[model samples]
Target: MNLRNKIAAGTLVLASATLMPFLGTWEGNGQNTVYADKLARGLPTVCKGITRHTSPYPVVVGDYWSNERCEEVERLVVQKGQLQLADCLTNQQIGQNTFDALSSHGHNFGYVSTCASRAVGLINAGRIAEGCKALAWAPDGKTPVWSYVTDEQGRKHFVPGLHARRRAEARLCSQ
Candidate 1:
């Protein structure tokens, strides 16, 4: 083959290899799939024991049903994560661990938030550890688990139940 043809073939091979891992199915043990599965498991399909929920979409109060399956939840969560990631972090390559960690955060909250932007900036700047720490600092983008704000009635309002998730996301990012 000529030099031009060789270069073209090499580029095609590289592009295909890079995209294949994402496009291909996991069959059972993909990291992102497993991560998504674990994260979405605790979300209730029946909030307050009456209101029903569905995957890949938010829960509507009036439209409640209890027929959604577990596999459907996993698929929905993964699809949402992928879509969120695609929308926010476009045209850039990310490692599996980073992808999984960020996807977890995106799944829990959203990708187009202040926290996600900070994490993306840190990761893009090659400050992986700092980025991971930032993510742990603000899992929900607006509230860090360690923060406490005083309400108008002089009561301390705390954002509970997020520290653990933040820690988990940080752990995944560092890995």
Candidate 2:
């Protein structure tokens, strides 16, 4: 882990005893797949053909599979993820967008993982805007908060996909 992750993890360990209230699960007719796809990084496959599948776990992109197998993976991953978020947070009466955003983050990292810890703290503190913004920073924790970096040549490096997930989460949180 990086320095930021280490710090967040240490903080969560100290705060784990506290129980956060439950928020609703990811809502939508088909939203789960959308948020999950961002995390899945895999293509869906079935009947010896590849389509696109969004799963919480890693999968071989072009592997063939039965429809049942694909659904099972999605179900299990979502179930475990919900349980993890339920365990990690308290007093979470957040809206669909915010909740889904956080759930995505929790599912990707661990619910109690340091990165989550930071976002959790901000959310709980009622700094909704800050918290939402923090979600985008949760990945490596070193992603430039200002959205840019300086190279040795004194050249400015604009971070692109590095915080794309976080940006998506932040957008959801704002809604």
Candidate 3:
């Protein structure tokens, strides 16, 4: 079924059908394992990037998640994220690809932050292509942003993985 049709069916439709595989590619389906998120200051994360903040259950360090439980929680979290993102968007008629891309961004960076970003401003102004490009670039349109992590020493360091993910998100948004 198409995205619009799925939307009409229920909120559960979009996350499971469209965004799951897209997110799985980037987030990595960790299956039954729980690990620390180094970038987020060692927050316990499990099953396709479910952290304590996003998880319905308390994320314990050694807890094991079954495949079914992981999928269920991921779907719930992604759907909640989609609703949060939709609330922040002024242009509700954006295409599925654009929405999915933005949802991915919202998933990684909080929806509130995504709402306040320059990319959202550009998209609201009806410059979608430029907005997509803005997801990966700074105001200079050359330097990349959102591709670094601050360490305990308060120093910012470049992360190749984040850079790649941002570029991939931009491509998805442009589509």
Candidate 4:
């Protein structure tokens, strides 16, 4: 089935497929490398941003994943993330672009956190445009929420890449 049909059917398989390139573009398909997540206080991450918490296999700092293993894990991780996000928005009637944007944002920040965000609250309140705007800003309406990455000292610094990603997500959501 096509992505639109699958989305209309309330299934996320095709949606996941459609969102894979978006995720890979942002996350980078580091299939064989396990690196420390500077944003997450040095959490070991591998294979398209799969951490120990997200991956089915162990995610040690020095570990290397085979291409097939990485592909399988990436698919599993994205599917799980989509499921979590879908469950959170079970009652909301949103479009494919909005769902894809939210899925991407949720994948990076976390589905639970995204669901509880001011953006989601606005969406639930039927203010979708405002919700899309809210995705790029904090409750104070000035700070870029997802643009900061934590350093080893636990200090947060703004990252242009993350800010750009948020902007892209907001644009997608607004569409």
Q: Pick the candidate with the highest lDDT.
A: 3
Q: How many residue pairs clash in each candidate?
A: 0, 8, 0, 0
How do the residues 1-175 of candidate 2 rate in per-residue lDDT, one tens digit apiece? 1122322444222112111111112212222222223222333332211123335444443444455664455455544554556555553444445655666666445456623567767776667677787776644656644335456567766656435645766787778
lDDT of 3 by residue, 138-174 (tens): 9798899778999999999988888898898899888
List TM-scores for all candidates, in order. 0.51, 0.51, 0.90, 0.84
What tens digits encode model 4's per-residue C-alpha lDDT throughout 65-113? Answer: 8989988888888777776776666434677677888888888888899
Give, for candidate 3, the lowest lDDT window spanning 10 residues: 1-10
* Full-model lDDT for every candidate: 0.47, 0.48, 0.80, 0.78
Which is superior by lDDT, 2 or 4? 4
lDDT of 1 by residue, 1-175 (tens): 1122322344212212322232222212222211222223333332211112324455443343333433344555555444546455432444556556666566455546623567767876667777777776764545564324455567766544455556666777777
Model 2: residues with Cα > 4 Å off, grouped in runs: 1-63, 114-116, 138-159
lDDT of 2 at 98: 61
Q: List the residue pairs that clash in candidate 2.
A: 20-89, 20-90, 20-91, 21-90, 21-91, 44-52, 44-53, 136-166
Ranking of all candidate structures by their TM-score, best first:
3, 4, 1, 2
Which ten contiguous residues of candidate 2 have the minimum total lDDT?
14-23
